[model samples]
Target: MDLSSLRFAHRFDQVSGSAIREIFKIIARPGMISFAGGNPSLAALPDEKVSELSVQVLRDHGKQLLQYGATEGYPPFLESLKQYVETAVGFRPDAVLPVTGSTQAMDLLCKALIDPGDTILVENPSFLGNLQCMKLYQANLVPVASDDDGMDPADLEEKIKAYHPKMVYTIPTFQNPSGRTLSLARREKVAALAAEYGVVIAEDDPYRDLRYRGEMLPSIKSFDREGWVVFLGSFSKIISPGLRVGYLAGREEIIRKCTVGKQSTDVHTANLTQAIVDQFIRQNLLPDHIRTICADYGEKLARMLGHLEDLAGLVTFTRPEGGLFVWAELPEGLNALELLKKAIDQGVAYVPGTHFFVDGGHENTLRLNFSNSTDDQIDRGMSVLKTIFREAK
Candidate 1:
């Protein structure tokens, strides 16, 4: 028999590789100005600080870190992480499980809760990575309608009633791709709805600390009295994504299930990285670090938005207070997927927004990232994009 005749899992039949990752391959050429990934700025990664922390942790706990650790978490990280979650994240979790990254956190949650054909209510243009994760679990992803204030409560309730979904995944703050934050009222409403309908709310809030202009809002899990909301957090944006340290916080039972699931996943998040992040929390390093990141990213965001303002009538975009991305919709009949080819030719790139949608039809929309690029890159890249969009219009 030919090896090409092998059968793979049926769950992957409808799924494909990440569109953003595929775009990355195209944009890897020298001089490409990419606005595709939700990457932290290179300058913001705190390399010197991480190096110092890594040395201190290794010297102090060399043997312990090298040894296999528990699936639940690194014990010291668990202590500091819980306190950080309470103070910085504004939620007191019943339990917390440290994962390799928030991406793994999402996978663990899906593994724990979802069976094939289970329903998951998602924001229409949700995070593509997680959308792909849900699909890998063979989930029926139902889109809940959203506006500038983020996911609408009324529609969310209606979807919950109609679908009776096992989980309702939301970014809630500085949402991925869209950069729209959920309103405070809707946050409370979502928490209440989760409790009322017995549905799980996956509050994935990696960019909450990256705010530029607005007052901070409470996490959806803060209002979750019945422990229905699971807060997924990451240090990727504020710290370093290379470290791959993130956590899941929620009810003990839910966390326990994820812990068991994680055991078969990676055994545990790398203990060395966990210790470094634990020290970041314990030494109170995040506040000053986050402030530095905000100031720089805020300027980049402003510069990009200023460029977008030049096409006011021809393009409409979300004005996010914080986050890496700005979502834009070109005039109707203008396709962003087609525009991307022209953009790459001009040495610029952005992810088409249709890739973020569950059903994939919004061709006019595109997602731009400012955090990873320099001021000159934003000016030049946006200039290239502006010209392309204007000519297309």
Candidate 2:
């Protein structure tokens, strides 16, 4: 038999590769001003600092770092991380488990909790990557309603009543693609709901430190008294993404389950990276680094919002206090997927927002990332997008 005739797993029957990854390939061409990926700017990556940390960590613990490490975390990182979680993240974790990235945190959670056909409630326009992760686990992803304040407590309660979901996955702070944060009241309510309903809440908050404006809101995990909420955190947005160091913090039993699940998946995160991040926390380098990043990204966000203001009649977009993405909706009867062809032709690129939807069909919406682009690039890219959207209208 030909290899093409081979049968594949049924889990992928409804799942497809990420649409954003395809856009990344197209945007790789020379002179492409991409607003597609949630990437940090080159200037924010701190190559020099990372180089210094890498050398120091290796010299300090050369043998241990090169060797296999524990599934839980590197010992030094484990200690520093627990303190960082308590002081910075505002929660006292019963346990913490380091993973490859926050994305892996989602996978491990799904592996620990989800079985095929078990329902998982989600925000309608949630993170694309996590949505796909749930689908692969064969969980029925049901979308709850959301508005300016984030996921509605009323609708979320109703969904829980109707579906009796096993888990509720949320990107509570500076949510990806949409760039909306859950309000303080809703954060408390979500934690309460999880405790009452006996459902696990995955609070994916990778961009919590990327705030550009407004006061910081407490994490949902902070209000989680019963230990139903698990906080998934990442250094990808603040530190270098290439480092791929993220962690999971939750109740002891739940974290133990995830730690076991993680053992089979990559064994453990790279010890070298964990040690380097450990130094960052111990030396308290993150505060100053995050401040510099917030300043640069805040300016870019304002510039992008200004351009969007000029196209106010032509488009409506979210004004996020912080986060890399700005979600925009074109006029009705215009399709962003179709407009993307025109954008790529003009050396500009953005992700069509329809892909972020669970069931798909918001054809007028698109997501733009301002963090990776310079002011000149934003002006030029938004100009191209403006002309294309206007012509389409």
Candidate 3:
């Protein structure tokens, strides 16, 4: 009766970051100020509208919302989402499929398109979950280098040529843990590379709408005329992360494949959430709500920027126009994780840059989340950070 035959897949054997689990444990502690989560700001969660929308959904679409939803997700909400994508993002209506969250949309794409040992080209400092998903599927993740301006298009193209990758994964808008927005030229370069190389580009854009300082850049999906990119958009940033509503858009053939894959994942996303999101959109409440979030976060980001301006030489960081985070690289020879541990002891927490990379990561790098901090807290945190920078140096 040996269970050795139940040995797990090779993909499951690799070690994971202890930092993630440690952060999870400390998150719920009282009086803890966390910059660890990449959550949309509390300013963004449309509570009043959500409550109103939920009531509307129940009053008008109660029975349908509570039932087992379609595997492709709610039709009315999907249609609304499709229109939003088409009108705002320059997509065709037939290309998008709603899912439980942007993460699930990524999962669906991975499951359908990634066979074991397939190559995945990823940003050097990349999203942890995307790396985790690729790892679970035994994807040979090739890391593409990047710079302050954001992902290096030439590096990505080189990787594509070398690996003939299964997919190129990116968080182009205010990239996670980096807050680095890809320039328009770079976006076009990468898009061209994807089209030329016959590789799929998976663009996860949850924070695309969260900008406080920058001009809008067209999405990579906007250049996806050849169906080379699968764009993932989420309501988590605009509505509520807890609701977990998101969608994926690509060529209908690829979307159809993902839909079939999703059918076996959770059957479908929760009907109640979709109904609420749909109701909110129909009532024309989303624009005002988004404006509120943008305004609040804009002030917060400004405060952080003001505080950090003096420490410019001692430390370096991205000043993202829009998005939740500002990525900082400590002066040469410092370790961000060590700085984080010291900062935590002094009543602050942030994610180290290691968690963001798919390959080589800078030890001196760290990410600060401005959306969650109060203006007073921003000052205090920066004061502590200045002390840490001096000590670490």
What stretches of model 3 exceed 4 Å from their correct place?
1-6, 15-17
- Quote each prediction's TM-score: 0.99, 0.99, 0.95
- Model 1 off-target regions past 4 Å? none
- Tens-place lDDT per residue, model 1, 90-121, is 88889999999999999999999999999999
* Model 1 alpha-carbon miss at residue 79, Å: 0.5
RMSD of 2: 0.8
- Write one digit per residue (lDDT tens) for candidate 2, span 1-393: 779989889999879875767898999999999999999999999889889999998998999999999999999999999999999998888899999999999999999999999999999898988999999999999999998889999999999999999999999877888988899999999999999999999999999999999998999999999999999999998998899999999999999999999999999999999999999999999999999999999999999999999898889999999999999999988999999998999899999989999999999999999999999999999999988888898
Local distance difference test, candidate 2 = 0.94
- What is the C-alpha local distance difference test score of candidate 1? 0.94
Clashes of 2: 0
Clashes of 3: 6
lDDT of each: 0.94, 0.94, 0.82
